[model samples]
Each structure stands twice: as C-alpha cells, then as structure tokens.
Target chain A: MECTDFKLIVVGGSAGSFSVVSHLLAGLRPDFKLPIVLSLHRLKHVRSGLVEGLSLKSKLRVIEPNDKEKLQQNTVYLAPANYHLFVELDGTVALSTEESHNHSRPSIDHTLGSAAYAYRDKLLGILLTGANRDGAAGMKEIADNKGFTIVQDPLSCDIDTMPKEALKLFRPDRLMNPEDILHFLNALPG
Target chain B: MQNSEKDYNYKEYLLILKECSPYDFSEYSDNSIDRRIKKIMRDQGLNMEELVLKTRTEPDFVEQVVEAITVNTTELFRDPDVWNHILKKVLPALKHQKKINIWHAGCSTGQEVYSLLILLDHLQILDRAEIYATDISKKALEQAKKGQYFYNFNAEKYRENFKASFEGETVPDFDSYFSADADKDLLKIRTDFSEKVQFIKHDLVKGDLPFYNKFDLIFCRNVLIYFQGSLQSKIVERFHENLFPGGTMILGSHESLGGFFKTKFSKNGPVYHRTNSFHFKY
Candidate 1:
C-alpha cells in the first residue's frame, strides 16, 4: 500500500474524466519509470483520437500497445478500443474481445482486477471521475490483494458515481484530489 | 514466481489436459488462458480437481474444453475502417498476380472470411482468388464451414458493418450476398461466397502449413493476442516464411511486429508490407 513499492500503475475512468486525466498526466514527472496502464471508456466505433488526446499532456510516450506487448518502463499504455486489456502473470499484457463485461470493451474492472491478480501488492489501482460503476469491484480486488487503491475525492469529481461506488464496496487506501494524487506519485521513492 | 501456488495449479491443469488431449495451451499467454479456464470451471460447475478428473475420464469433454479455451468471439466486419482500408487499398494493390492467394489463420466462425469475400466479389476479382482458412478448434472450423450463424449474433451486425465500411460510397445490394431466415433466427452466407473458401483444421500453434504455395496476403487479425510474446514473434516469423516476397501481412488493428521483426516487415498504412530488400543478421 505504499507508493514506491508498486511495479505498475493502473488508472480507470469513464465519463467526465478526460480533462482530469490529462491534468494528472501533465503533472507527472518525466522520469517516472513505473509502467502506467490507462483503461478509459471510449467510443468503440471510433478507431482513433484517444491516444492523440492523451498524448497532448503525457510526460512519457503514450502508446496503444499491441497484444502480447511487454509492459515497458517510462511509458504510458492506453487500452485500445474494442479490446479488453488483461495484465498477465508474466510481464506482458494480452488483449481479448471476449464478450465485453459491464457493457464495455476495455473494461476497467478487467484491467484493474487483472493487474491486481498479476502484480498483487506491487500494483496501484486508481479510480477517477466517472458516471459508471465499472471499476468498483476492481478497487476492492486491489484492496483484497494488499495493493494500494486510490479513489478520487468524490467532492472534487465531475461525476462522483464511480468513486462513490468504490467507497461503498470497501475503504480504499487513499482518497485524494487529482492534484494530491499527482503530488503523491511525483514524490515516490526509487 | 510471486503467485507460484496458483501457477503450480495451472501448470498441472494444463499438463493433465495435454496428456489426455491433442490440445496444448502451455505456450499461451498465462492470464488469457487462465481467465478462460476460470470461466470454464464456473460454467461447467467443476472445481480444478473435478475438472482434471473429467478431462481424464471423458474423451469427448476434451474437445469442448479446447473450444472454450480458445476465444472465438469475432463479429462480421468487427472494425469497418480496417475493412474499408482492405477493400480500397490492400486488395487492388494485388492486381498484378493472375490469381491471388489468401490464408486466414484462426478463422473463427468465418465472418471475416465472408466479409473479405463480399469485398473481393464487389471488386469482381473473387473468381480468380484462392481462399483458405484454418483454425485449431475443429468445432469452430465446422461452424465456419457450415457458413451459418444466429441472426442476432451476426446477421443484424452484418448490414450495419457493410454500411459503415462503405460510408460515402453507395453500398451495393448487401442482402444479395446472403440469405436470412428470421423465423429460424439464422443467417447463411450465400453458397457462392462460402464455396470459394476452403476450411482446414490447421492449428497455428502446432500444425504445419496446410498449403504448399505461398499466399499473396495473410489475414491473422486478433489471433496473435492469445499467445505469449515469444510465440507472437515466432508466429509472425512463420508468416514471413509463408508469404510471397511482396505479400502483405494484415494483423489486428492493434497488433504489429515487435523487436527484429519490426525491421523485417515494414508497416505501410494499415498493413505490413513484407520487405525482402535486406539480408541482415538471422
């Protein structure tokens, strides 16, 4: 449940959170080495634009990784549209089109829960401003696995349903504003 | 080795299944296969021990287990933009060849093959094309050969995908390509389209090339996502060996050749144009 011990960082969001995510990414240290995986609900029909949008502010290279691609350091990997991103027990990620869970491909729960399963206590799971309950069980899974879980402070969210849902399921390790989250990540030890 | 306890169990489960059946998923990406295994356990209401017992005792059940393990959740023209690119760009580029050869590795339920057929037919070049498809799952190969799918599962989506692929252009009579029975809730790819395709039970992970001749293009979309990174490279390398010098390899939209393979196959827009210009380190 500590910042420096994490091997991977997973962030999940749905509605009204892109700007917040951009802001957080804008503030992250350029030297950040932990592999960050972002799973956001997107227009599945549209093939492009999410990476372009996120790349505008990310300090590290933002890529929609190919399947079976290794989790690389100093990079931000965004889940591609129409695919579920599962973190493997090995140091790679696999993509699947298995009937979308919770009505969304690249399901946040799948990404977060799989990361929790793969990295256990070496993972940090974050739930951001969103209108859906897709990432609630995933945050609890992170907590159960002794990994750190951070839910954005509900009062500071554009839509609080996602964080509120997570809070209802289990107490996470931290409740912070986007700025605080950025600060905590930036201040992490080697 | 952090979760060695669970890892040990999965290794045992895989070994037991391999011992009893022809299927071997040991090289598959662990999370992808393990997650499917967990679902199989739930759906069949068998714990790991009982599952292994069933696999041992029931020869017939092994086939079902293999089907479940391999993910075959494809839809007709799942991504229209990619199909649009194929129809407009990739297919027409192969005009020099008198007869084009195509191989669809892991052709699940055959929707993609049918989609390509419809395109090639529109281009009026299907008569001179040799189409072959292969899948590890015999059941999936049978369904692909049958050329039928539940209406809700693929029929309705077929029309939608057709329209999207030809967004600006006036799409042809898409209905003419297929026959549908709403009462039976089944849709069949017309005999004309289905007959041109030859389905073979070729396992990409194990089986050798089903055809001796090299292909002009290989469509292996979304199939490599199931294997480990090492296997992904190996599979792509195998495709390189099976392709004609100037042939193109069309992978899933999100996939690409990594490491040394990147140098081997050069990406040109939507497809990887196989490059034979250099003979570098092996």
Candidate 2:
C-alpha cells in the first residue's frame, strides 16, 4: 500500500523485534520529517542503553524524551523504561507510571490509544513481532479511529504471538515484512 | 493550525480547572496534564464547553475531574524489595531514636504508608512512629483516610509481592490485612492499622512541604516520574531539607536523584541515605 500525509508514526514491538526495528530505522532517510515514536517493551528496572543502541544504527536522530517534551520532526523518540509514554492533543509527549497494562509499562495499547486520539487519521500505527499481546488492542484503536494501521506479516515474525494477536483483533490496512515497512516509511513525503 | 487550536483549548481548560479547584496544575508538566484531560473528555463524551460548564456548576464534579487527572495507581507491597531494604537496613538504624517521624509524600491511597506501618508493627516499633501521608489530590487523600477499598484486595498478587520482598523468608499472611465488608463488595483494612497516620492535603510541586525539620524517613515513590526534570530536582531538594541528617528517603524504582543531590545521598536500589548535614545551595 502506498500512503502519505501522516503527521506521526507509532511503532510498537516486544521480544525478538529489535532487529526488524533496527533494519527499518537504518533504511529510513535521515531527513524523514515525520516524528516516529517507539514503544518497545523494555526491562522495567534498567534505564539507558536502548536509545544509544538504536541510535548507533538509525540515520535519524534518536532520543528518549523527558516528560512533556515536544514532538519534533525528523527525530525518533523512544519511550523510557518503566514509564508509559503518551501523546498529547497538542502533539507533545507525556509519561505516566500508571499500573502496567498487559503486564508491561510502555504498553503499546496506551501509546497507540493516545496517538490515535491526538492524530486521528494523521497517524500510521505499526506493530511488530512480540511475545505478548500488548499491541493488539492498540492497533485496533488506531484502525477504529481511521488511522492507518499495519502489522508485520505473522508468518515471517520470529515470534508470531503479537502480530497474530493483532490479526485476531482487527484487520490492519497492510501486512508487511521488515523490508516492505522500511520502503513504506521511506516512501512517505519528506 | 490544528495544533494551535488544541493548544488554545488545553490552556483554557486548565484555567477553568484552576479556578474551580484548590489545586494548580499549571506548573505540572503540560503535555501530561493535557493528555489526561483529553482522556477524561473522551471517556465522558464531552466537549470542552460541556466539561468547563459542568466543572463550574456541578458540586463534587471537580473532585472526579481531579481524581481522573491525578495519577493514583498503586499496589500493596509495590517493589517489595524496597520495603525489605527499609525493614532490614534502614529501620534498625532508627530503632534507638525515641520518636520516628515518617512522611509519605504523594501517598496515593496510602498503600505505601500502610505497608511501612505494617512493617513497623511487625518489628514492634509502631508505638514510637509518627506517620504523615500527603497528596495534592484531596479526593485521593480522602480515599486514603477512609482506608476502605471497593473491589476486594488481590491476596494472590499481595502474596506474590510479599514473597518477592525478602529472600528465603517465610511469607507473611496477606489475608490478615483485609476483611470483607457487609456487602462483600469491598475489603477494608483494619482501622487500627492506620490509627497513627496523619493524612494531609499538600501539593509537592507548587507548594512548600507541610512540615520542616522533622522527618526521619520519606517515601515519595512513582510521583516524581510524572514531573518535568527541574521540578524533580526541586522536590528532591525539598526532600533533602525535610529529612534529618542520616535519615533515609525512598524513591520509586524508576526514579533517582539528579544533579548535586546525587552527591548528597548514597543510593541502594530505591533507597537513599542523607549523608551528613545538608545546606541548600541556591
């Protein structure tokens, strides 16, 4: 599917998904103007390292935002460990320590739900391979709100539980492999 | 253009909230507050005009609004290891003191305060402990003071959390804390457990701490992560000044002291010890 006109891109993943994320980030143009927010499941106790890890491979600037930091174009923002990240109606970031939903902080459901509310049809939501079902309901929310939604092809995932769960919840606008998603993001108007 | 419109709506709503309630949310992180307000609006199916009008005209409507915006999520024996650390290393050091002054800042619904109290009671030190629990949300403080919770306490989660608190120690009976109410819809902690706790309504972000020069231990968990970086540092400084020399402060598992306060306290997982006397550096 060829798509554009999105203001924000949200990506959620868990176990065995980092390599796909890294590959996708490496392929995106350095000047890609849409703000991309990532909500990868992380160890709740440790801080740091993850952003640095992603930044090493990403062409775009990678950052972990402080509470209330404004979303900026061409930057990749990762949710900090142990805090649930949210998007505000005015397009800034909010962090919450509310009880872990689906047994994970930075749960995909919370982030995507907020983004779906804030950006509506202007959001592109992507769910990748994960061991848990955290992103299923969130992807559903995005699709329900008229935002474009995509899931990594379950047959190709190292772990299919997450994408399979999303498939069970709602039909996504596109089902892709890592390379297709990379090209899709790169093809968006800069 | 869309962003500007949302920004205008957000600021106006916050102004309405400030005028209608005792708390000022203006200084709290803006995006967090805005998202929460939007969540409330979405849940209630109300537009900004409806929300503002209801907030102005409806009595106790503002309370529900405040509760919705404020982060009150907590659990019994949260991060049990922190409690274990306090019980093992911190409390014995204060055992000889004739009086213990403890403050649980942003003590949402009072679970951490009561957890500490239960530990003190187990150690047979409750008689000398003076506990102060404070939160910015009056609704939360009211629930805390009432100590009655609908939706029965989860004994299994409680047991699991307690088991994780200590290494190889026999688990305490979690059932002892809660008894069913007449309707069987709620589980209320025995009133005697909270008899010594003094619940106060205080804002940690915009206002001065309610007390000065008296706390031996302070528990301000999960609350700091909600704030912006500067506010976190400021509140940590206030915590330092409030704590007695050699006293201990416990932050949430995810939070830590920033800047120079990092030097003022020695850290142990989630616990920090005030080293020597502190002088607030302007």
Top TM-score model: 1
Model 2 misplaced regions, further than 4 Å: A1-11, A14-83, A87-94, A99-105, A113-125, A129-150, A156-174, A177-190, B150-153, B168-170, B180-186, B206-213, B277-280
Model 1 Cα displacement at B64 (Å)? 0.9
Per-residue lDDT tens digits for candidate 1, residues B1-282, read 556777788878998988888778888877778788889999999898999999999998998888888888787887888888888888888766698999999998899999899888888888889999999888888899888989875665678888888766669887788788888988888987787899998878874886865989899999888887778877888888889987988889877677788878888877887889566755
Give the candidate number with the greatest DockQ.
1
Candidate 1, number of clashes:
0
Evaluate model 1 with DockQ and give the value. Answer: 0.65
Candidate 1 chain B minimal-lDDT segment of 10 residues: B151-160
DockQ per candidate: 0.65, 0.33
TM-score of chain B of each: 0.94, 0.88
For candidate 2, write residues B138-244 as lDDT tens digits. 87888888777664445555556666765455556656776766467665676887667999988786657665546899889888767766788888887877888
> What stretches of model 1 exceed 4 Å from their correct place?
A1-3, A29-33, A44-47, B150-160, B167-170, B179-187, B277-282
